[model samples]
Target: MGRRIGIKDVAAAAGVSATTVSHILNEVEGKRVNPETRQRVLETARELGYAPNGLARGLRLKRSNTIGFVSDQIATTPHAGRIILGAQEEAAKHDLLLLMLNTGGDPELERKEIDLLLQRQVDGVLYASMYHRVVEMPEQLRSVPTVLLDARSNDPGVPSVVPDEVLGGRTAVRELLSHGHRRIGFINNVDDIPATHGRLEGYLRALAEAGLAEDPRLVVTETADAAGGYRAALRLLQAAERPTALFCFADRMAMGVYRAAAELGMSIPADLSVIGFDNQELICDGLYPGLTTVALPHYEMGARAVVQLLALTGAQDQGTGPAAQEMLPCPLVARASVVSPPRL
Candidate 1:
């Protein structure tokens, strides 16, 4: 291709100085120029195909029109890819670019990535995780406008956008209860994770709300995987008076539950109702009977983090406020996995 056109070319074509061209094209605030001259400069630039240099413009304005997106395993996971897509789409809407870097859960690599992003003078930083948990922010990240996605920071000044796990847990139980299930079993994930605690709280809350006594024998905690689910489900189903319905902490766990049910010669929704969290289509839709589950709202959390970061950076007109800890809602996705308990 021929030599690319620049602002100097536009200036020459419009018979105006390069400074005047810069002022008109960049819309430098508080600078006054004749309307006809402004129109002429714009038309000439367009005709010449002149494009502004993002790096140079950012240097001059002391603000980069770029966002640094740092994630720990989220980029590599197929289930959470929508989070990146949502952030990218929202950034484009504001005419900004996203520079993504995945650290694969390496703290040293994460620090290096943040240093590189800061060197580029990114306007803001978005720290995301594959799952919702508390994150320790790197010292370098504290200097810039930053927001946490599907995670929380120890620093109260940093804002976070995550799904409401407690609400999700309650919704899952309510769905089972609505189907006339009085005896329910909860197959929980490991006890240390924040989600485990929150979900258990919701389960207890829902049972209390319905005037049902908590059954100690009905609750079991195991690893957050299919094997764990299988073992837990076996124990729950083998009891003399087994629960008519089961609520799993995650979709993967629910898949294990399905296996256990099949082994016991039980059909889903007919013999035993089941519900799961995380509307992972791979597991939920692929099951013999589509698994009813709750969605984590990954996309909404990603999109809202960008919006909130922009507000923190004064890039948007939304009112400024104290650091926000926003929890987006998790909506239930109904499917064939849940039904009324079978009558004796």
Candidate 2:
């Protein structure tokens, strides 16, 4: 309604040049300005309600101070929402605003969303997925400072922040082995996905380390859901040498194992020890006995993606080297589902 306070008003009131005020407010590195002048300029700006015009500033600096976050169903999913929260928090720490967009796993929608963000002149982009997999990055992303979250590009040139699935798998099996489980079976996801391969590799590695033979009969590949888990569990439980413990690829599948165990009149940890991955709280905590599982590190992946994207954007501005890929660790969450095997 009234007159808008400008940077010049703050400079005049603070008894300083516009250049000095710009340096102090924008925080241009290595520019030596007196502390007293800096404090005075900030106080004057606060008192005058001076807000910089984002568009004008962006045009001048060729940086929007805004990061674009594009995800395929991660933003809308309940369990994966933490990834967005983490990215937003980190962006705020650097005084950057985030523009979030969801594509619902549709390639056409993905391209449209990316084009829209580019048209808006976002400083950089963060591409994320609901699950860990290899994604083909759109050509538009190649020209911008882009980082992948919870996914990797087939091209090694793109930077990504993803969970260490192999380590998570090893940790799950190691927890079972520590409880004296020699006959442990694995209910795995289908072989095509990246997580399935990495997790299965860890499973086999842990078995080899423990001097146990790899048993084809003890492993079953499923669809990574409740129905698939139920069918796979039935097959394992009906075997002549039924496994005493089971490691599921995901918590959703673990729910199916619980159902099968119930049908067989088997008690959790008393008759069958179980462990799962992706520690979805709704499934894990609501189970009769809380399910012990490996966390997917969704929050960490999102936070690290922002950190990497900012770093890459800064590096590009400074003519530095290329961005590097990062993988965050998944921690084990102990609960009531796992216990020592019953003595035969």
Q: Identify the candidate with maximal TM-score.
A: 1
Number of clashing residue pairs, candidate 2: 0
Q: Judged by lDDT, which candidate is best?
A: 1
lDDT of each: 0.91, 0.90
The C-alpha RMSD in Å for every predicted model, in order, reads: 3.5, 4.3
Writing each residue's lDDT as its tens digit, candidate 2 over 29-120 gives 99999999999999999999998788888888887888899988865466567888888889999988888889899889988999999987
* Residue 88 local lDDT, model 1: 83
- Backbone clashes counted, model 1: 0
Q: What is the model-wide C-alpha lDDT for candidate 1?
A: 0.91
TM-score of each: 0.87, 0.85
Q: What is the lDDT of residue 293 in candidate 2?
A: 97
Q: How does candidate 1 fare on TM-score?
A: 0.87
Instruction: List where candidate 2 sits over 4 angstroms from the true fold.
Output: 1-51
Candidate 2 versus truth, CA RMSD in Å, comes to 4.3
Tens-digit lDDT track of model 1 for 197-254: 8899889999999999999999999988899999999999999899999999999999
Cα shift from native, residue 34, model 1 (Å): 14
- Candidate 1 Cα outliers beyond 4 Å, as residue runs: 1-50, 315-320
